[model samples]
Target chain A: MSELVHPLHRFIRPSVKYSTFCPGCGDGTVTQAILRAIDGLGMNLDDFVFVSGIGCAAWIPSPFFNADVLHTTHGRPIAFAFGIKMGLPDKKVMVVSGDGDLVAIGGNHLIQNARRNIEMVVLCINNGIYGMTGGQAAPTTPMGIRTTTTPYGTVENIFNISRLVMAAGASFVACWTAAHPKQLTNSIKKAIQKKGFAFIEVFSQCPIQFGRKTGVGSAVQMLEDYKKRSISPKEAAKLSEEELKDRIVVGELVDLEKPEMLEEVKKMKNKARGEVE
Target chain B: MNGKRVQTGRYFMMGNVACAEGALAAGCEFSAGYPITPATEVANRLAERLPQVGGAFFQMEDEISAIAAVVGASWAGKKSMTVTSGPGISLMLENIGFAIGVETPCVIVNVQRGAPTTGMPTVGVQGDMVQAKRGSHGDYEIIALCPSSPQEMFDHTVIAFNYAERYRTPVFILSDAFVGHMREEVVIPEPEKIKTEYRKIPEPGTDPQKIKGFLDEDVAPMPIFGRGFKAHVTSSCHDEYGKRNLIDISALDNFIRKLSNKILKHKEEITLIERDYEGAEIVLVSYGAVARAAAMAAAQGRKEGIPVGTLRLITVWPFPGEEIEKMARGAKHVIVLENNLGQIYPYIKAEAAHDAEVSFLPPRLVGEIQDPEDILRKIREVSK
Candidate 1:
């Protein structure tokens, strides 16, 4: 008989003993899904560089990943990823940040990078509320949800982050929840293999800040809700817009070929150097 | 023309274009910026020049992202830069602080325009002088260079990059519209003649656990990305190994002191001053475009037999107090000149006031260069 070790243990830094996430938080599940995806693809952490911004989901990479990690200012990870990708065009650059980070303050960088079609994988962990700042209302928070900042209930409409990235010209777009870790991991694998700006919006549960305080119930209850509300894009295609309003549309929305930014830049450089017409 | 890294010939070039050429000669591999008046020419030149040299320039959405990208590129083991004006610098302050906190080596060019808030886009002013030093929140030291002419714009930009790389901090090229757009003869030296520096990085196979990548008084080897260093870079207070230590009061103190000390410890090598104040009773002190006028005034004052000399601050931050004190001790009266209403005067006085009487000579009006005749008159009055 041999002692068993966690297969995904090698991906984490030797110095990091525990994750900073709260108990049963979906961010941990998402972390496992990401590490599983990287491991499943037979790629080591050495070839990848992880970038994150300020928030709970941002903590998913820094100090945890045994790779080069850049934990940047709030809402600026994607912008920083642009430079990292440009500098090391062959190396895989990934950004893991939250909904408020990638959508609200960092929306311009997201839209612009997607439009440029730069090669990077952006994992936008959407937990509906600002968990790090004590359950403040976020841009992805559904209307009428009571958060710390929205005591009277949020009056603003929530951002459809997948649709936003899709419209911004991302080459790959997908949505999944923590409840579907297998599918989420599969999408991460696909995103890593894709060429241009790939975005995955993971609907994660914040059991502490976004759970009982907001009436979303316990961690188990939130997972059940996510499992029940998630509908496949194919299945949702058969429903009317009114009937599908409450359903979370899951799966790949767009994945196809396009001229990526760095590839075009290479050609442009050659043209400028008079090496090619 | 596109493939050439240095146009090694003398040409009457605009100060902004000279700066771009200087960056190329300094081996800047990545450039990112947004277009703004007076500074756009630097971006335009770089946009056209960088690609030919197997480098790239990105025109980001805003100044915030522009500086952020430069910092990221620097961590990716490339010498990077960003150019902008005063309003843009305001947008970049937070990320600039991030660069300082993480010890990222990058150059920032502020082709300054008149401002409180977009005050004048085309006119030159030195209003952002102190901003380059103290605009970011917190207590930290910075390195800044003031280039007064098109030639110095080219020369100082190279020096800026060297200081940034050597010190592992953001170095500012503080130019104004008068200097940035001024057309003058700029000599681009052969590539071999230019001295450029690259930041030291840890040996390729050094144990990741043993790598002390940050907070060394003598400047630690940068554990830049993509080299198996597995560096963990964050703005939060940390120890020498780049580990985040948010809980300790002593750790925060070390984080702040060690970063500032990294540059301050090298003050002798970092400070640059041009002095001709020997045997003079009244000395005119200035920097940037205003220094050109100060030089002319001092020269004219000497012709009239008044004992007047000039001390031009080439390296403006770490504040150059020692140089100022030395200059003041030799002179009875010190007059500080600036295009704006005395942005650096208080700092100058703090250093010089104990030795000599210090006075600020603002332009007759903001955005106007001090007339050489008016400066001479002031010199004569002060000497009397």
Candidate 2:
């Protein structure tokens, strides 16, 4: 068993001999799905730069991936990735961060990047709570759910991340869970191929920190819940809003073509320099 | 230095505009900033200039994202900068510490205003002197410069970028509202005459990931992303290979010591001062806008048969302790004048106490520059 090799071993850093993910954590599945997407793209590893903010999901790419990874401060991966994309417009920049890191403190960056339609792929791993910090309520944590900070239950309404990005004018947006690995991988692939502000929020599980408190005590149970509650956008449209309140509407929410920010900046610069009419 | 030089000429330019021009001359290709009073002009200038020069400028969502983007752009292989005021600097502290931790080279311009939280927007103050050095959490040294006039604002900005690139740390141009907003004849040097130094890049094809000791005493060459150097950069304590090492005390100690000592070890090269200590009984210690007042007062004191000299600090951090101590020893009194409630006076007092008596003239009001007559009065008072 020790000699047995994982197929994704080529992409993993040999120095980090063990995974930091907890047993039954869905972060591993998400990581594998992203790796599979990159592999399927037939892109050179050097051509990709993986940027992340602080969290369990942030750790997914930091020391684990063989590609150039920038592990930045919490809640600022999109901003950091913005810099990277602006500096090297040719390289494919991807941001992998957690829901708390994105929708909470970094929510401004998320919406602003969407508004500008900057070219990058953002993988927001939504585990419903702050898994690394012991299940604190996050912006995405459903209302009435019990968390470390909200012992009685959360009072605030949850952020509909897909709708938020869609409203902000992202070129591509989608939501999928680890239960739908194949579809998640495909969405990631399409996002990478997309040219402007691609955001994919992957629903992941935190059995130890979030599941036990939320009544889904095991990873398998959480996956079952996701499968049971998940619905496609078309299917969700058929159901009443009240009936779809607890359901996860999965699949591409928006896909459109727009002028990317960097290209516009280049054109603006050329016009300013009198090199273009 | 590697780029083609633009034509040079004299222009009646505001200090903030000169600062933007200096950045352009020094090869800064990326800037991200959030507008605040006084410093807004710097952003405005960059917004207009960067596009003409084929560089990128972003008005970030806020100060935090502004500096964070600058750090990111620096890692992506561009000379980057950001301009802000006290409030913005306060917001950028966390990421500034991140820049220090990763040893990323960038420049920050703080056109200081009255502080403690939105004190006076239009008024210039030198209150952020100590904050510029110690604002970010952690044990690290930074390079900070203060410019007294529009010309120096332009000159020091170029020096700030050069030092930031040479040291691989965030260098600050600590101009005040007075200098940032004031207009003067700034002689723009031909690009060839403007000397700039960039960070040393690793030899092509060398795997930066395989190399260790990036923060060694000698300082490792920077290997930016997308250049085939697959390096992992983090804000946490890390080993030589850029891998996270949270528990190892020795590695942490080595990294921290090097991060600080790289500046301390080259204090002579980093420290810049203008001094006239000959036959001086009183010395006026000053920086930024207040330095102009002190210089005029010192000249007046000399004309009035008092032996008054001045020590103008160009580089404020890695504080010119040795120069201050030597100057203090030869003088009977050292008077520190600034547009704040004695922020840097304590450092001067600490360095000059045993050798000479130190006096402070804090800001008279929120936006007031120290009157030359007031500084002259202090010089006369101390001399008597």
Candidate 3:
């Protein structure tokens, strides 16, 4: 009889025999979706580079992926990926980071890279709490959510990262939960092919650190909640503000063309050399 | 023996501009910096010149991001650097530690201005001498060079890159506003004439999977990303293959020790000193722009029959303790001059204490160079 192999076996590192995620965690699901997206596009692994910052989401690519990876400092993956893209203009660079790693400390880099229309894709896993640091409240943590840092409840309003990136001028933006694996995979594939700053926020389930405190129940229950709460942008537009207040706005938020930073840089170089008008 | 210039063309240039040109000549392909006084010219010049040479230049959002970007560029197989002042250096301390942890090869130019906070924006001070060594939050050794003139600014920048690449650590060009803003004639050597060094890469067929640590006692060759090496670099305490080993005591010890010993073991080759201590009763120990005044004082002291000499430190970190010990043994007294309240004075005194008497000449509170006459007067009193 033939031996059974994992679907992502070809893309994952052989030495990383076990997943680092907690039981029933969504990180592994998101990892599989990303690998599936790359496999579907038939992209050469040699041309892909993964850049990540501190957190569990950052580990999604570091020691696991077969491709080149840079596990950088906290909240600085986008800034680091900017350098990598600038150095190797032809290579496809991608950043994987957690909500705290992206919006809390690294927000400046995210906004600036988007404003410049730098050519790279960013996948931010918004689990609503700092998982690696034991469930502290994050920027994306919802109001009234109980966390280690917010015993009574969070006082700050949650930041809608999808809307934030869209306003920051990303060429492409989308949101999906790990429950919607197929759609998440498709969105990732499109993001990979986009010419300039693409950002996708994956609303992943953090059962151990986030779910237990918020009364979100088991991992299976959280996935079910995602299925029930998610709405398409078109559907969201049709609903009243009150009706859409607590819903997860899933699907592509923005897709438009603009001059990419690195391409403009090349053009400027040519013009300076008197090769272009 | 005069070496041929790599891109030989002499030009009268500001010290900051000379530093930029020196980086270009040294094959630095990437630079990321934020604009700050005194050091802004380095970024301004690189912005105009880097793209012309097929190199990349970025004006990052802040000093923290600027240094972070340069560290990233280094791992991408580009020789990278960042230029900033004291306040900017303060913002970059954490990332500097990150670079040390990963053993990334890059250069950092700190054109220091007077500061406890934002003390003096337009004037020079050597207040950050110790900060450059201990600013980061870990036990690590860094290479720092001081330049007294535009010519040295240009020359030292090239040497800084060479040392950074050779040792796979962040090397510092610790220039001050006095030298960074000064204008002088600088000879641009031909590209071939300027010597350069690059971090060693793993052999072509070496499996990336088999690799353990990126550095050892002899400093392992750098294995960058996208070369099929799959080099796993992290800021956490890591093993030989760049894998995190948080609880493993041996792994932590090996990693931290190698990070320091790589530069410390080669202290002789890495340290650079300029001395003229023959038959001298008193010596002035100094660096950066203060060294210029110290040199003048020594010359004036000799005229007055004071028998003074100068021991100018070109490479400041690893502290050049051996050279200090030797100089102290031969002289009766050593005067340490700096633009701050004795930042490097203690180290000098510690090295020379058993052999000779060491004293400090602190900066004039009004933010002016210690006048040559003031230093000479101190020399006369100390000699007696």
Candidate 4:
């Protein structure tokens, strides 16, 4: 009998026998969801160029995926992706990074690219803490959490990353958690097809670091908590502010048709050449 | 709507504008920059001109993003560049190191102004001479060209791009505010006459597993994205196939040495010097704006019956020690002239001090070029 292989294994690098993710890490689930999204869309990996910044989530596409991947410096993958998209306007450019990488250090790039409405997908794996650096307090870390750097518990409010990108004029924006892998994959597929800046903020679980700090204890427990707190936008709208205080809003926040940067650049080039008015 | 890549005519042009023209002639498809003094003209020219020739220039949010975009564009199979000054260079050093680590080819132009930190944006100074090589915080080699005039601004930028592509590394055009803002006659050659080079890429349909696109002594063909090579490019220490190898000591060693040797091995071809040191006892070694004063001083010294010569460094980084050493061998005194307080002087001294008395002759003031009289007077003192 022939050996059984997972369908998504085809997207993994042939030389990589195992993943670098820690056991029970949500990054692995995020990785699989991304590959599944591509697989379901019947798109060749060649059609995409994946860029990631310095973080565990960044490693999802770097040495793992069997595609063109640019694993860049800390907090700069979105800036780098702007160039890649401009150079290869026909190819899809996607940026995968952690919350600390995307929201804290790389926030300017994220905001600027969203404002430009550049045609690309930025999947921010919001793990809440800096897991790779051993549970440091990230900008997205919830208040009153005792992290490595915040032993006294964080006093700062967490940033709503999806709302931030949506405010910054992204054409498409969505929020989902790791527990909702099927829906996350569906969003990824739609983001890949979007003609302007598409941002997906995935509330991922970092069981070893964040789980230990937040008393969630394990990946299953974290997922169970996510399932309990997750609410659709419709349900969220009906709830009172006090009642919806801790609930995670999970759904598309905005979807709009806008002029993209590269397409505008093309039109400018044609106009410069006197081929267009 | 004339989309000529090279405007073949003589025109009085600003140094920064000439630089933009040179980049266009060298086939630069993309550029990104932020507005900083002594360098804004380059960005302005590129923004207006690139679209006509089927290229693009993005004014990024900051210098870091500007350089990041340039490196990204290079990996996507485009010749790209970024322009800035000292303050901007400080922000770009980290990503510059990233570009070096991954062997991405791109050009960086620094229109230098006075600074320890944003001191004088409008005044020219050779303050950042050493920063171009050492600012990135790693043991690596870099190529830098020092253009003295508006004409050299046009010429050196072309060389900068060609060297960037041929070596698959970042090449710098180190122009000071004096040269960057100066207006002079620049002769633009026909597009066919301008030598342009593109980075070598793997032959079409080459197997991805077998393609060695990094850490080659001779530059490896770049495995650009969207080419079905599935090229894995990382700023981390990686193997020939662009695989991340963090555990092995030998892999780290090879990563450091190979990326450096790729430039060091071709040093003879990479170094450019204008030699006029023959039959002289006193040699004035200078580059960029100071070289103009040095050349004048040398001519005046000859008329005054002193055996004074000039060795103008056209390519300043990768240190150009051999050229300095060779020039020093034929001289009794090697005097380094610079606008700032002796940045490259120690390096020149290290190379030439063994053979001759090496000393630095700084300009009368930091922002001003060295007066020819000051250089000639220094030459007389050294000769005596």
Relative to the true structure, how large is the alpha-carbon lDDT of every model?
0.93, 0.89, 0.88, 0.92
Candidate 2 Cα errors over 4 Å, as ranges: A1-4, A275-277, B1-7
Give lDDT: candidate 2, residue A96.
96
**B121: Cα error in model 1, Å:** 0.5
Clashing pairs in 1: none
lDDT string for model 1 (A138-238, tens) is 98888898989999999997788999999999999999999999999999999999999999999999889988788888899999999999999899999
lDDT tens readout by residue for model 4, B216-331: 99999999998999999998999999989999999999999999999999999999999897899999888998899999999999999999999998988888888888888888
| CA deviation > 4 Å runs, candidate 1 | A1-3, A275-277
Q: What is the DockQ of candidate 2?
A: 0.60
DockQ of each: 0.71, 0.60, 0.53, 0.71
Alpha-carbon RMSD, candidate 3 = 2.4
Q: What lDDT score goes with residue B168 in model 1?
A: 95
lDDT of 2 by residue, B45-126 (tens): 7887777777878999999999999999999989999999999999999999999888889999999987779888888878
Q: Which lDDT tens digits does candidate 3 get at residues B90-126?
A: 9999999989989889999999997879887998888
Residue A267, model 3, lDDT: 85
- TM-scores of all models? 0.99, 0.97, 0.97, 0.99
In the predicted model 2, the residue pairs found to clash are: none
Task: Give the Å error, residue B266, model 2.
Answer: 1.4
Fnat of each candidate: 0.76, 0.75, 0.59, 0.81
Residue-level lDDT for B349 in candidate 4: 95
